[model samples]
Structure formats: structure tokens, C-alpha cells
Target: MYKAHFGLREQPFGITPDTSFFFACPSYQEALNTLLIAVRNGEGFIKITGEVGVGKTLLCRKFMTTLGDEFVTAYIPNPFLEPRALMFALADELEVSLEKDVDQHQLLKSINHRLLVLARAGKRVVLCLDEAQAMPLDTLEALRLLTNLETEKRKLLQIVMFGQPELNHKLQQEAIRQLNQRITFHYHLGPLNKDDMEFYVSHRLSIAGYTGGRLFGSSAIQAMYASSGGVPRLVNILSHKALMLAYGEGKHEITARHVRAAARDTGAARNKIWFLGWLAAAALITVGTSIGWAYFK
Candidate 1:
């Protein structure tokens, strides 16, 4: 709705994990590198954990796209299935055809055979599971069993799990110790820093065809960082709302007022009392600076 007003080709702050809008912040890049290196080395189990809306899924998608022909990847976006169902899902992803009446043993055999065949062909197999925290204990064990299918030289199948922080708690359970011990590489994705947030906002705007002058002022960006705690998804939500508020008032540039309004509307604006105190201090400093300048002149 504010695209035309802002001279942007499209909405700049959409919540979707569109790779085109991906901002390669330092933390994100490190996570990506960790995942890539782990996968390339054929690590048996790699785990990536992050807070909600911290771009784990986006990183997972980007990782998948970056894998070349040397590797075959299977992604399970939802891993809440039972052990048997989970095996069957992996089988489906690998295109291992099985009879309708096949049991768990038959399914495991089929999957193992496919993994061995791929291994023999010099292609590495990686299974990426998202939302792995919701997976049942038995299902997790089943996944661990899959990793056991290995040749004498190396593992036949590797697994990369991307999930929320709760996934760590799940892995810490006594029943899942075996799987936990198998994870050789792990990374915890964190929120962006102040610099990264600024770059991220500008990058998104630039990608959306913004050619106008600066839209968000320094104070506004600081306000956003304070309100969003440097989380990309929260930044997107606040920035989009701030733009809409600016457009609604027929303004060209976003100000602290717009950011405050956006933050208030989104309920992400914490420390209101402290914010007011800071505003007062800033106003006093501005007045003092003006007086000192006038006196010197």
C-alpha cells in the first residue's frame, strides 16, 4: 500500500523468507558457513538453533540452494510425525518406491539401499529436518538409526536439523543422548546488531527499487533498533508499519514519531518510560547546542 508513496517497487519489509531479500549479516553468514562446511564434510548430524522469527528457515532454504550436484538434499519441513511415518516421509523424499503394505523394516531397508546406492555414485545425501523440536522421541531415535546406515569409510546419510531453541531442550533429554552426542557441528543463530539492522533495512529498500532520498532518519533507525531488539522479523514488521504510518500522514521521511507510533501499534515498543526520559535528555541537549552555537556566533 505504501510502495507508490515511498517510490518502492514492492513491499520492502515482508515477513516471508524470500532469499532475494536476504541480508547477509555477519551472524547469518557465519551460520551459513558453519552449515555448509558441516554438510560438505559429511558430518553425521548438524544442528542449527535460533529464536522464533530469527530466519532459521531462510538460512535452511539458502543452504539447500547452495548445495551443488555433488550432494542430494531432502527437506522435511514438518517433523512431528510418528517414527514409521517419518521413515516413510524420508523414503518419499528419496524417491524410494515401496509396496503399500511395507512395514518399518522394509521401509528402512529401502532407504538404506538408496543411501548406499547414492554413496557408491559419489553423491552425498543430506536430510534436513525443520521444526525438529516437535518430533517425538521415538521418531528422533528412528532418525538416529537412519544415520547408522553407513559404509566402512564414511556415513551414508547425513542430517542437518534446523529448529527453535526448544530443540536444544529436546536434545538434552536422557532418551535422546545418543542423537545429541552424534551432532558434531552446531550453531545458534542470533539477532542482528545495530549496524546489521541499518544495513538490512537499507538493503531491503534498495532491493525494492528505492531511489528516493533517505526515508528513515538516524533517530528513527535507533528507535527501531531499540524497539525490535535487532531481530529481522520484528524490524520488518516495525519498518513496514512505520512506512504505512508515514504514508498515511502524507510524509516523505520517517521520523521518531512514526517509529514510536509503529512500535506502539505492534506492541513491541518496550521501555516506554525510559524512552521518554531519553527523549527529554535529547531535547535538552539540542537546546543547549543551539544556545552555545548562537553565543559563539
Candidate 2:
């Protein structure tokens, strides 16, 4: 809605995991680097964890796009299936044809054969799973067994898991201890810091074709940082809302007042702004009382 007023080619703050809007903040870049290195080394299992809205899915998509022709990539966006069902999903992702009413044994066999064929063709198979925290315990073990089909030189299949922090806790369980131990390369993605957050906003705006001078005021950025706690998703939500508010007022520059109003409307940011506001009011009252007491003395 505000794109025309802001001169944006597209919506800058959309929540979709669009790789084009992927801001290469420090944590995201480091996590992607770790994934690339681990996969290139033929690591069996790699884990990337982050808080909700920390851009794990975006990073996963970007990683897949970064792979060369020598790499075969399979993406499974949902991992909450049973062992047999999960195998079926993997087979589908690998484009392995399956007969009607095929048993688990045949499913595994078909998958193994496809992997070997790809390996012989000098292609490294990489499987990426998003929202992996919901994967069943038995299904996780089945995934580990799939990795056992490696040749002498390297693993036949590499698996990358992107999930929230709960996935780490789930991996700690005894039921999936082996799978947990198999994760050779692990990276935790965190939210952007203040400087990175500012750059992130600018980067996204620039990618969306904004050539204006500082659309967001410094105080507005500070308000967003405090409200969003440097989280990119939250920042996007706040920024989008603030832009709307600014557009509604026919203003070019987004100010802290716009951000505060946006934060008030956002459920995740509303509490934080209210708390900060309370603190500010309390401090004002304390200062007023101290001055009155000093004057009376």
C-alpha cells in the first residue's frame, strides 16, 4: 500500500522467505558459510537452529540456490511425518519412482539406488529439511540410517536441518541421541544487532528500489530496535507498519512516533513498547519528586 509513496519496486517487509530480500547480516552469513563448508566436506548431518522469525528458512533457500550443478538438492519444508511417511516424502523429493503399496524395504532400496547413481555421476546429494523440530523420534532415526549408505570416499546423502531452538532440546533426548551425535557441523543463528539492523533495513529498501536519503529517521530506527530486539522479522513488521503510518500522514520521513504507533498495533512489539513507556514515565515521576523535595528543603 505504501510502495507508491515510498517509491519501492515491491513490498520491502513481506514475511515471505524471499531470498532476494535476504539481508546478509553477520549471523546469517556465518551460518550460510558454515553450511557450505560442512556440505562440501561431505558431512553426513548439519544442524542450523535459530529463534522463530530469525530467517532460517530464507537461509536454507539461499543455500540451495548457491549450490552448483554438481550438487543435487532436495528440500522438505515439513518434517512432522512418521518413519514410513517420511521415507516416502524423501523418495518423492529425490524423484525416486515408487510402486503401489511398496513396503519400507523397497522404499529404502529405491532411495539408496538413486543416491548411488547420483554419486557415480559426480553429484553430491543434499537434503534440506525446514521446521525439523516436529520430526518424529523414529523418523529421525530412520534419517540417520539413510546416511549409512555411504561409499568409501564420502556420504551418499547429506542432510541439513533448519529449526527453532526446540530442535536442539529434542535432539538431546535419548530416543534420538544417535541422530544428535551425527550432527557434525552446527550453527546457531541470532537476530541482527543495532548496526546490522540499520544496514538490514537500508539494504532491503535499496533492493526494493528506494533511492531516497534516509527514509527512516534515527529515532525511528532506535524505536524499532527496542521494539523488535534486533529480530529481522519483527523489524520488518514494524518498519512496514511505520511506513504505512508515515504514508497516511503524507510524510516522507518515518519518525519514532510512527514506529511507536506501529509497535502498539503489533502484538509481539506492543508489550515491549508498553514496558519501555512505563519505565520512561516512572523515571519522569521520580525526577519530578526529587526536584520538588530539593526545592522544599
RMSD to the hidden true structure, all candidates: 9.5, 5.6
| Candidate 1 C-alpha lDDT tens digits along 1-297 | 889988989999999888888778889989999999998887999999988878998899899988999999999999999999898889999999899899878888999999989988999999999988889999999899889899999999999999999999988999989999999999999999898899999999999999988889999999999888888899999999999999999999999889888888775464665688899999999999999999999
lDDT of 2 by residue, 1-297 (tens): 889898999998988889998888778889999999999999999999999988999999999999999999999999999989888988998899999999978989999999999999999999999999999888889989999999989999999999999999989999889888999999999989999999999999999999999998899999989889888889989999999989999999999999989988999976766888999999999999999999999
lDDT of each: 0.91, 0.92
Write down the TM-score for model 1: 0.88
Residue 277 Cα positional deviation in candidate 1, in Å, after optimal superposition: 17
Minimal lDDT window, size 10, model 2? 267-276
Q: Clash pairs of candidate 1? A: none
Segments in model 2 whose C-alpha atoms lie over 4 Å from true places: 271-297
Error in Å for residue 296 of model 2: 37
Cα TM-score per model: 0.88, 0.91
